[model samples]
Target: MKPLLLLDVDGVLNPMGRPTIDYRRYRCTIGTEVYTVHLNPRHGRRLLDLALSTGSELVWATTWEHHANEWIAPRIGLPALPVITMGPGRPRSEHGEMFKTPHVAAYAGRRPFVWFDDQVWAEDEEYLRVSQGLRDFLLVHVDPRHGLTREHLGMAHEWLTLTGFSQGP
Candidate 1:
């Protein structure tokens, strides 16, 4: 089975901490709140290429949830991908792990997956290593100050190839 690629928006795609010059600003409304986000246009193509090369399904794992599809996808030139639902009351781990860790593990189930986010901590990694029992999984932490860079994409591609998910040409 192809691996799953979980994507986060704020830090991974939007890089909110970075200078505004690197992205195009857009104003979007989610629920009753109107917010502005800066998204790098090149990242969509990079992500799409990674997904296609690895035969992995791209999924939205951001807090924005479905709103990512509505606002971020179009701006980045990505189609609407599946979103990970954050149910009532945030899920937490006993070791101060990320709230999304359990949800991501549940979504991945027995499937091999890769998750990209800025907030992943060592606790989350330890939780996955001990509890998830995943043989082939990658958790990449992208710097929010830089978002997704070509170097990051290269690392992901290398991992996919090393894991036998991509038959590089």
Candidate 2:
């Protein structure tokens, strides 16, 4: 079986911290007071497209939640993916905090995998550090200007090869 690859949409795939003329809800807070939120620069859609083409089972681990599929995916010309929605409040690690690594690892049958996200540090990095094979698992950071740059994708391709996810690099 091919190893799993994790992907991040923000700085890795979609560029945030920029400007957005259009407005769309990116998050929701079902707490004492209900609220809908929008990210500063929403570009997750484009990143979604790039990720899907790779033939990996995609998961949305961002704060966007349902909005990623409801709004962002359509706008960016990408299809809906398995979204890993966060709860109202949850304790997170110092790095790779949001990543549900154990779940992901289980989902992938404990096989090798890769992750691409600008926000992941704790779970993702730690998994890479402790996993059986170092080169089999990879984490790619996408550049904003170039949708999914070749460098990052190429790096993933190499890592995938190392893990037997692909026969050739």
Candidate 3:
């Protein structure tokens, strides 16, 4: 099975706090609520390049859920991608992992995956370790202030390359 590249919108793509000049503000209307997001177009290209080189499929694993396709994808130059359905409410596991942890695991289904999120904690890592034994997975913690950086992508690239999941030089 092809490896997966799991993406989160809030911190990973639409970074919170102050943003750099490279990021552009966008107005997204989800129902009656309007949300402003900061996005860097270059991130889209970089993510696509990384995925292509790694032979990985990008899947959204965020609270935005299907809305990511509507608001996040186009501005970032990505096409429609699969999204991991989040369970209702903000449920925490006994391990204290975030609600998205179990859902991401079920969606990944033993496939090697690279997950980008700011909320990932040690607890999440521990949970994944016990749940997905021997599966190659990389959980990249993207800082909400900086969003996704070249350095972050580099880490993923290096990991994928080392794991024999990358098809590029």
- What's the lDDT for all of these models? 0.85, 0.53, 0.88
Model 2, span 1-169: residue lDDT tens: 5455555455544555442444344443334544444332334543443345444555665566666676556654556777655556664544443445544454555556666666445456576456522434565645443334546666776666554565322
**What TM-score does each of the candidates earn?**
0.93, 0.59, 0.95
C-alpha lDDT of candidate 3 relative to the true structure: 0.88
- Residue-by-residue lDDT tens digits, candidate 1, 106-147: 898887778899999888888888877756778899999878
| Model 1: residues with Cα > 4 Å off, grouped in runs | 167-169
| Model 2 root mean square deviation, Cα atoms | 5.5
Q: Any runs in candidate 2 off by more than 4 Å, and if so which?
A: 17-55, 94-109, 127-136, 142-148, 167-169
As a whole number from 0 to 100, the lDDT of residue 144 in candidate 2 is 47
> Which candidate order results from sorting by lDDT in descending order?
3, 1, 2
Among all candidates shown, the one with the greatest lDDT: 3
Model 2 quality (TM-score): 0.59
Error of 2 at 106 (Å): 5.4
Question: lDDT score, residue 129, model 2?
Answer: 57
